[model samples]
Target: MTAEIFATTPEGDTVEIVTLQNGPATARVMTWGATLQDFRLDGTPHSLVLGSPVFEPYRSRMRNYGAVVGRAANRIAGGRAPLNGATVQLETNEAGRTAIHGGSDGCGYVNWSLASHSETSATFTITLADGQAGYPGNLALTATYSLDDEGALTLEITGTTDAPTFCNIAHHSYWNLDGTPTLGGHTMHIDADSYLAVDEHKIPQGGPQPVAGTRFDFRQPRAITTPQDDPKLDHNFCLRLPGTEMHPACTLRAGDLQLEIDTTEPGLQVYDGSGLNSEVPGHGGVPYGPHGGVAIEPQKWPDAPNHPDYPQITLNPGETYRQVSRFHVTRI
Candidate 1:
């Protein structure tokens, strides 16, 4: 493990970036948010995911670029949910209307501790106190990133809370397999027949909607964007209810490079990066703008706490919450 001090937070917390390698793949992970700062595969000329060389952008403009965002990965209606027979009000970070990504002080924005590491794997841990972020529980969370001999990257996250609370985490990485200015030539395929419908506020309305005959259909590999693309996606594609076994969720391809994602989660959130205009540059000083990359996040359904019909997001005491996801790239 090659580790170095990345930066210090204003709170006087130290952050470190660690490098792990196996076979043809190398991943640089940081303690802040347990982020995957950069990922590179041998023979590839550029990073597969968008990132920054310095920590300033990550702390400011590019908060979620390559971090594990959570407590609750997506939105919660009105920032309120019923927990343990009582209603709990969470921090409404999104427009002061909804709780998005566990509120403003979410795990993604906080500094974590480097627990352990090997040459090809690293684990980061953080603890959220009871009543913090308006959630009940003293939750201990761990995020581990590992690489296999075949260059596949695996992310395993686990949470155990002293009290019942909500726990849904997602890796937020904006991927651009070709290093292009935009996702013009990228094609994607998601193994989902339906997706959640959202309101104007981007909150789930009710049940799942069929993807057939809709622009949301990506059953077969298709270009991420066309000139006539409508309803820029920031929605979740329903995979299945949470399960113990991992399943293939999606695949993304650009030219000869391909990325395959498998996860144990139930939903895949596909954000087209339509809102990603940033003055701060990305890795290698690359300018990030609309369609600069696409974020494919696997997690539990959004607003699960409010919708009893949706997959549940509650983590009770003595029960361990676990999510496993793998990202493998190959020359296609």
Candidate 2:
């Protein structure tokens, strides 16, 4: 692993970017948000993920790009959820109606400490105080990124809380395999039969709904395009109930390159970057607009705390929250 000071945060904290290489892949990870700043293959000409060259954009216009999001990832309706027999109110960062990615100052916007590093791996750790962002418990979180010889990037996240609280973290990386301005021609396949139905506020309205006979279906490889009237892609595809074994989640292909993802989480959120509009240029001077990339996030179901039927996200004092996801790319 090679490390360097990337930039300094507004609070005078120095941010470091660690570059890890193994076999045919290379990834640049920064301490800010425990973000994966860049990722590339040996034969690829451009970075596989979208990122900014400077730190200012990450803090301003591109906060979620390649970042580890959450104390709780995704949306919570009305910024409220039932916890320990009481309603806990959280920071409503999304238009004052929804709590997104653990609120406005969630884990993705915080600077994490580099806990350890090696030639092909790095681990970052952060601690969230009890009641921070209106959530209970003092939570200790760790994110470890490792590369294997077969060009697989594995992310393992573990969390422990001192009190009962919600904990669902996810690695948020926007992928653009062709280095194009949009995902116009990319094809995707997800191993899911149902998806959550949401309301105008992007909060789940009910339980999981079957994807058959709907535009949400992607069981077979299909083009990742949306018409003007089609609903934008930003829903969680339910894989199964939370389990310990890793399972194949999805796959994305662009010409000769394909990315395969496997994870232990029960749901995979596929955002088609319809809301992406960045003022700053991405890596390699790529302009970012709608559908510039797609974010495939593996985590527990969104708003799990409010829905009794969904997989519970409550983390107790003695239990540890763990999620392992692997992304492997190949020339197909």
Tell me how far the alpha carbon of residue 27 in candidate 2 is from the true structure, in angstroms, after superposition: 0.3
The lDDT of each candidate is 0.93, 0.92
After TM-score superposition, what is the CA distance of residue 147 in candidate 1 from its true location, in Å? 0.3
lDDT of 2 by residue, 185-268 (tens): 799999899999988887887899999988888999988885753788999999954454999999999978999999999999
Scored against the true structure, residue 220 in model 1 reaches a CA lDDT of: 97
Give the TM-score of each candidate.
0.98, 0.98
Candidate 2 C-alpha error for residue 245, in Å: 0.3
- Backbone collisions counted per model: 0, 1
The TM-score measured for candidate 1 stands at 0.98
